[model samples]
Each structure stands twice: as C-alpha cells, then as structure tokens.
Target: MKRMSLASLAVAGGILAAQAAAETAAADDIFACYKTAPAAEPDWTAIARDYGHKRLKQGCGQQWPVAATPHPQRASAAAAALAVKTTPRPAPVSDFIWFVRKDFADVDMFGKPQSNEKATGAELSWARNNTAADTIWQVNGLVGLAYSYLNEDYSRFIGASLASYVKVDKEAHSAAASDDSRDAITVGGSAEVGFINPIGGADYVRGSWLETRDGILNRTTGQAKLEWMPMYLRVNRQIPGTFVTTNFRPDLKVQYDERQGGVVPIGFSGFGRSLRIGPEATFLFRVADFGTTLPAWAEPLAGLSGAVTYHWWREVYSGQSGSWLDSTIKYDINPNVALAFSYQKGRNEETAKRTDLYKLSLNFKTCAAFAGFSGGRCTADKD
Candidate 1:
C-alpha cells in the first residue's frame, strides 16, 4: 500500500511558471473492505489479519443504533422475549463476501485541455476468507495502475488508475458512487484510494496529504483540480428487475492559508479558507449477463448521476468571502467509458461580486486503451 500527496502548479494572471525542481512521491494506502489477500485473488492470510477487523467495527457499529434506542412496539416485544431467553445468542454470519472495486478517472490532466490522446490503468484485488464455512468472513485489497503517452506536450501526465475493495462485497460492485460512504459515521476509517501524478513537478505537493495540508497552508496552485477526500454511503435495494441506490455524502473539510508571517504595507494580502458538502442519488436497471447497466439519478436523464455542492469560505487578507453552488452530471457510455458535464457559480463576497465556471468531458476504453477529452480552455497545463 502507498500514499501520495499531490498538488497543482501555480497560476497567476493567467500565466504558467516553470518550477526549478519537483518530485512525485509514491503512495502506500491499502484498504481491505470485503475479502482477504486484497490483491487479485483470495489470499487467506492477509484476509485474517487486515480486513476482518475493519468489518467487525462497521457491523458492530450498525447494531448500536438498534440496540441503544428501541422502537415503541419493538421495545415491548423485546421485553417479553427477554423473560423466556437465558443466554444471549451468537451473531449470525451471512453467506456472501463483500467485494468492492475502486476506480479513478479525470477529464483532463492538471486541468489541461484534453487532446485526442489515450491513457489507462487497471488494478485487481481479492480477499482471504476467515471462516471455511462462512463465505463472507475475511479481508483483502487490490490495485491497478496505467499511463498514456499519446498526448503531445505533457504526455507524461496522461494516465488511468484504479483500486478495488475486498472485505465488503458491496464495494466490489459499487458503480453508483466513487468514494467510501460508510466512513462518514465511523470513528476512524478510510475507503478506496487513488493517485494522479507520478511525473509532476515540485511546485505541487507530492503525496496523500493534499486535502489536509492544502486546507491549512493554502499552498495549492491554480493547476490543481482533484485533491480532496470524499466519503459516500448508499442505500441500495433490488426488487425483481429494478434496483435503486441512494447516495449520501456529508463531508467536513477545512481549507486555510492566513499567509501569515508577512507584513504588507499596501494591497490586499493573499489569504483564504473554505468548506463544502455534496449529496447524490441514482437508479439502475438490472439487465441480463452484464448485471446492471444505465442508472438514473439526479437531474432528468436515462442512466445519469448528478450532485449539487455548496461551498463556503472566508478571507482575512481581503474581507470575508461568501459561498456558492456547484453542480455535475455524469453518464456511463459503457462499462469502460463515461461522459460528464459540470457548472459552478457564486459571489466572491470580499472582492468580486460573482464567479462562474463550466466543464464537459468524456472517458472511454477502446482499442485496448483508455482515452478522454474535455471542452473549454484549461489553465493548469498551458505555458
């Protein structure tokens, strides 16, 4: 398992500056959710040690709600049963492994314009069963990595990557959402991890500490696009030929950069902070062989997924900035391809009265390779 801290290049006055030196660090964050081994196939030893503990905590945590506070009618029934029962019964073990997969995709490299180039990465995972008779009791993890060199200019940044979950079987099939949904309620837990840059410069941070570090230092460059960590929880149900999945993600993030330690005689100082929250929902049609294809949720479209986020921030250098709205829409062109569109707008509160943003992208795997494209000019990669 590896961890990486990634950051974007600095952009000011719509200009890109070259860095003298920069390095991309490797990541070592391994997650075991449903099986053992955690690689491509079941590795029994790894399962017994790593993944088993994670699920026990999750399952046991779920029971607390039902045990601590009982419903009116349910409490009455429990009291009567207590009188007849002597010793408590052991917990029941289900008959399935919680298989999960982790997929990472980007519309553009470092917010650069998407060319007709191609890039891709893959990861495999498996879990080790704890109980010979219980098919679901165990833990494991998996990972996939790929890169593309077809693009001109910064072809080195072009690539695809993935990671999968092994203890909780549901994760293996979680296509409706990307981040971990269960971690929101847990004490200290994590979900699938992904890294985008191994060939970037030093002007950006190197490893997995981006969200927290950037939140505090405000050292992020304008070229940075995906650095935050998000958790997701989905309630999915299957009835006959139809399946429904609901996504809930409540994230608490802190971004800061007082740019303290310096005293400027005039002009506004560069300091800022922000917090954001987003939620999502979707419905899938269970098809034959392929299991499920084309799901619909949020917005109005067949096989679509969308979410709305609210961003709040403040700045001492200037004044107190306000908040704004961000929206997104995505569709699965197929198992290996996807298309997305996004928009954002709001007020600066301290300086500018309004801010606007828009984006569109497509990702697909064909001809034994993965490729993507985006509309609108990108600021992260140009000189």
Candidate 2:
C-alpha cells in the first residue's frame, strides 16, 4: 500500500508540472474552455460556415476569435453538415431587363348591330424596365381584319397600329406596417399611331385613318395621352390572414387627338388635319394575390373615368365640347396569363353625336423582371 501511494504521488506531480508549463506558455493566446474541451471548440470560421461562407479557412492566424479561412476538417459535425449542403445562396443582383406579353382581344360596339362593327384582334406588348428601380417603358402593336356583307357588298377592313408608353415612378415606398404594402406615385405618357383600310363609321370616329367605301381606302390617325397618379394607398383586405389587397388611387389624364379628314364647313379650311384635347379624372381599385403572396401575384383590377373634351375645327363642328365616360376590368389567371375588358363612350366631331366601343382581351406570357413585380428575378447589387 505504501508503494502504491508513492507511485500515485509521482504521477500527480508530473501532471501538475506539465499543466503549469502549458498554461504559462498559452496564458494570453488560447481559450480556457478549449483547453478543457478542444474537440468542441467554436470560433468565427465555424460560425461563418454555418451561414454558407465555404471558402473561409478554419483559422485565419489572427489572435483569439480570429475570422479567417474555414477548415471544415477540424469541426466534428459541422464538416459533415457542410458536405451535405452543396448549394449556395444567390448573390443579390439588379439591372435593366426586357419582357414580352401576348394578348388577344374581341372588340365590338354598342348602337351598331352589324357584324362588321364587331371584330377580334391579337396584340403583343414589349416592355423594358430598370429592375433596380420602379420605372418602365412599353410598346404595343396590334393588327386585325374584318369582313361583313352590307347592301350586297362584302367590305373588308384591316388595321395596324403601334403604341408606346413610358412611366417614371417617383414614389416607391411601402406604407404597410407589416413591411410589404406598396404605395407609389407614377407619372407617365402614351402615344399611338394607326392606319386602317376601308373602315366603318366607328373606326373613323375613333380617329383611325380609313375611308368608308368598299376597296382598300386608307386613313391614318395619331393620339397622345399623359398619365399621373397623385396619391395611392393599399391595405389588407377585410380578412386578416389572406394575401388579398385592396388599393385606391386618384388618376389624372390629358389626351390630344389628330385625325386626317376632310375640311370643316366654316372657317380655316386650308388643311386636312383635325385637333382635339381632353382632360380626364380617373380612379382605380385593385385586389391581388388570391392564391399566393409571391411577387407578380395575379391581380384583378377595375377602373372608371370621366372627362370633358374640347374639339376645335373650322366651321360647323368648331368649338365643340362634350362629356366622355370609360370603364375597364382585368383578371389575371396566373402570373403569366390574364384577360381584360373595357368600354368607352366619347364625343364626336359631329354636333352632340357620341360613339361607344367595347373590347375584350386575353394576355399571356407576361414578364416584368424587377424586385417590385411577381416572377421577377432581381438581386440587390451593392457597389
């Protein structure tokens, strides 16, 4: 028993001496917890790897708590976990992009029972936007043909047009307390030029360049409009947990019209160009995200507008003023597909005469690549 006690004493002295020497050498540099449990050590390299900093080494050769290259081999379970997580988070990127949307419309009219007054058309809209911001530019083109029998005469009408719109968004801040509501003010302008052969009365009054006779007689028209949204607000719908949103905006528009036609009955008959200006007050209500709250969520929207137009010409039809009304509805089937319908009634160049037009349209393959739109691929690019 005495011999065993002396042996234990010598072992204890050797351990104590070794520990004291090691501590004296590593007193200021090493972690005390790691000295006791080196196998379960934690540091910045390990932490950074947890969030996907793969190329970083385990020890950057700095002082304690050093941020450096990640050496996954030193970690027990960390290395195994990282080996399984091969995919890396995408870096944020932002830039300008181009988009195309396909659309079809069946257009007809009220107060005209003839099938010639009804037609279906397809249109394509191309768009370009600054994905880093809320501004966009879009151009639309459409072509359609119509044939109908009237007075034993078969007349065919064909038309084509190109229209462009540009929007500059000055306010892009969301006002929702939940950090997702969208509130914006957009200022924009639109211009369209069109040509048609052997048109009807409705097409003629709508400022299309077309003659009423049978063969391919040509008529041309050009128009421009300004769009402004002074204020807008959006909120959760009546339900608390749904992704549906209700929004309201006050919209303003000013339009100018020029049509190539014959001379007026009274004064200034020197030219074939006619001019008119109209200012409108409009409002919009929109609800979106019925299925998912993803970006570019399909939305259903509606709008109404009223305006007083002033038309100027030489004699009989000069200094004419009248009221105009327009309404529209849109329903998106998915992020990439949708349908739209609109009705409009406006004053004519003839005294107190009015013309009404109806249109139904289908839209597909829609893409608006920006952070603000659904289905958009935008990454934050920091310089």
**Residue 18 in model 2: shift from native, Å?**
47
Q: For model 2, what is the error of residue 148's alpha carbon versus the real structure, in angstroms, after optimal superposition? A: 44
- In candidate 2, position 71 carries an lDDT of 37
Best by lDDT: 2
Candidate 2's C-alpha lDDT?
0.29
lDDT of 2 by residue, 200-306 (tens): 11121121222111011122223333333222221223336544333332333334433333332211122243343443343333443444453543322311111
* lDDT tens readout by residue for model 1, 1-383: 12111111111101211111110011111112222332333232332222222111112111111233333332332232221122243342111111111112222122221221112112122223344321211111112222322211211222222212211112122333322211100011122222323222211111111111122122321111123432112222344553433333333333332222223211122333322222212222222222445444422343454445565544344565556555556565555454656555774211222446454545332222223422222212111
lDDT of each: 0.27, 0.29
TM-score of each: 0.29, 0.30
